[model samples]
Target: MQFIDIKAIHAHSAAQIDAAVAQVFEHGRYINGPEVYELEATLGKFLGDSKPLHCIAVASGTMALEVALRALSIGPGDEVITTPFTWISTAETIALVGATPVFADIEPDTYNIDPKEVEKVITPKTKAIIPVDLFGQLPDYTALETIAEKHGLKIIEDAAQSFGAEQNARKAGTFGHVATTSFFPAKPLGGYGDGGAVFTADDQLAEDLRAVTNHGCKERESHYILGTNGRCDSLQAAIIQAKFANFRDAEIALRQKVGARYSEALKDYVTVPKIHPGNTHIYAQYTIRPKNRDSLGEALKAADIPSAVYYRKPLHQQEVFSHLPCAKKSFPHTEQAAQEVISLPFHPYLSEADQARIIATVVKAV
Candidate 1:
């Protein structure tokens, strides 16, 4: 009945969470505490340990992107290319860091930033590319990496929605020069409160990230760069660590099954999310496009079923970005997708009967 069923999720992990929190209370080190480092180490091992990826936990996903940009030295007079169809924070991070956010169109099928459109936007000032892993699926990083190497641009994987996804054999967070993910309560690997982390195999970059997130302190007495208070709370990290141990893998598998059920039942009535070859989608939002998106939403509402739109407007059309330059002359696909996509209630805890009811309502609506 709920959109994401967070209560059901917490019910499964409540005991483990209480234990973790009790340990936190016993120690009483709230900021950048032991639990935070434990979570980071666990995440590093989960992603890969061959090069031993460094994980830097932060206060929020937006702050993760901001810190990554700063560590990479991307700032004023530099241009960073990213998609126009994502949450505003993706592009806003670039502008906030004093860089220009160059908008690129997305692939109609996957709703990912088109690599071809990215090449057309490169100029002498272009510095980095932030390819968002939208809707729990990753962009074509192999193609994006080729483009970055040829132009000497840094690639930052905006993996806010894809913490548990994979491309080929590489985990989503291991794709670009540095990748970031959110722990917002609705995300696949969410925590109790706002949280995020940056991942990298580069040792020097890891050092910079740790320093920048901690008031730009290379050491307690030495301040070297401009930074912010971006450390992930100890309690949030403990809760997430507990949740991951209890149900993360099982939940990921359940998401795939749920996404497939939605696609099989609804593909005839609307456009289902497309998974590129060699990629595994985690279904953060099982978005679909119908010709009559608004009407379909109303019809489902009338049936006591809820539906929501992931994005109703592209960043290019937003008034705040009117002053920025765009990479493409037109975002035809991005604009078209905005009017057609809607998401039904999707959570791992949904019963088959509930899923069937949702499907029946959607089929009847469309």
Candidate 2:
């Protein structure tokens, strides 16, 4: 069975996707076309609260984070706190923006950044907190918000893995001062190619983000701040829009069902995902922790079942971040998780027969 089954997903909306792409081809406005704006508006409405958020589509998830930081003027000598248990992009963007990334330990249960650890790391230099929604469950934003308010720090919610997820009625992309989500083909709400979007309710920040992604120009020949070519392609936007119809209507609930089944069957054999109260997980990975993760993976491989690790090493242990002070600090939970966690084959389209096979293999192997 395929790991993510992107082909199966595409087949569900082939007609709509084909028509969308055909329209983009006919227009030939490959960059920042009408479809891009349409997608941004639609996403804004979907993630909006009392007010619709302003969505700025960008080239990639990394670009989305960098643009948010640049718009907030966070750079050198400023420290940005984030979880080391996440993808490198979460911390890499902080460093790319000339800010120091302070490592915070993750919770053993949720594998999300621990807010209490986040509070301990705050110093006078701390300017922002980037809490990643690891494995599709949101961290404690309620507690993190209190901390941010007390310290005058900005919260940049990294919802790249939990785009359609929710916490206490608030959507994932609407939580922090600004939030970002990826459309990498593997993400929950993926596109045909690399794409990402930033969400915010502040008008000025939204305008600034738009400018930052377009070579820092609000108008045709005038440049303001330093920026990059971070604009998302029109074709990618079209594909995302087409897929989003089905994703919003059915896929999110389907993922919940699939994840529940895996957790129910595997709970006795291994550690299943722990979703916090009032939060809905999209199960982007449906990761589990087994006593012998590597051995289980080998068994699954022999059984023709695909399995992968979200991260084999935490960001603090990465060679690129080794020179930083936080790199030397011990994060017991993050370290232990890196060794034990493995994601099984998961997607909204996973058939019952395939799921049973995967479950039986895992139960026997573990």
lDDT of 2: 0.94
**TM, every model:** 0.98, 0.99
lDDT of each: 0.90, 0.94
Runs of candidate 2 with Cα error greater than 4 angstroms are: none
lDDT of 1 at 236: 94
lDDT (0-100) at residue 89 of candidate 1? 91
- Candidate 1: segments with Cα more than 4 A from true spot: 49-51, 327-329
Please give the distance, in angstroms, between residue 75's alpha carbon in candidate 2 and its true position after superposition.
Answer: 0.7
Steric clashes per prediction: 0, 0
Model 1: C-alpha RMSD to truth?
A: 1.3
lDDT of 1 by residue, 1-366 (tens): 888889998998999999999999999999978999999998988898576689998998999999999999899999999999999999999999899999888999999999999998899999999999999999999999999999999999999999888999788899889999999999988888899999999999999988889988988868898777889999999999999865556988888889998899888988899999999989889898888988888988888887889899789888899876563357999989998899889888888999999888878877
In model 1, what lDDT does residue 179 have? 93
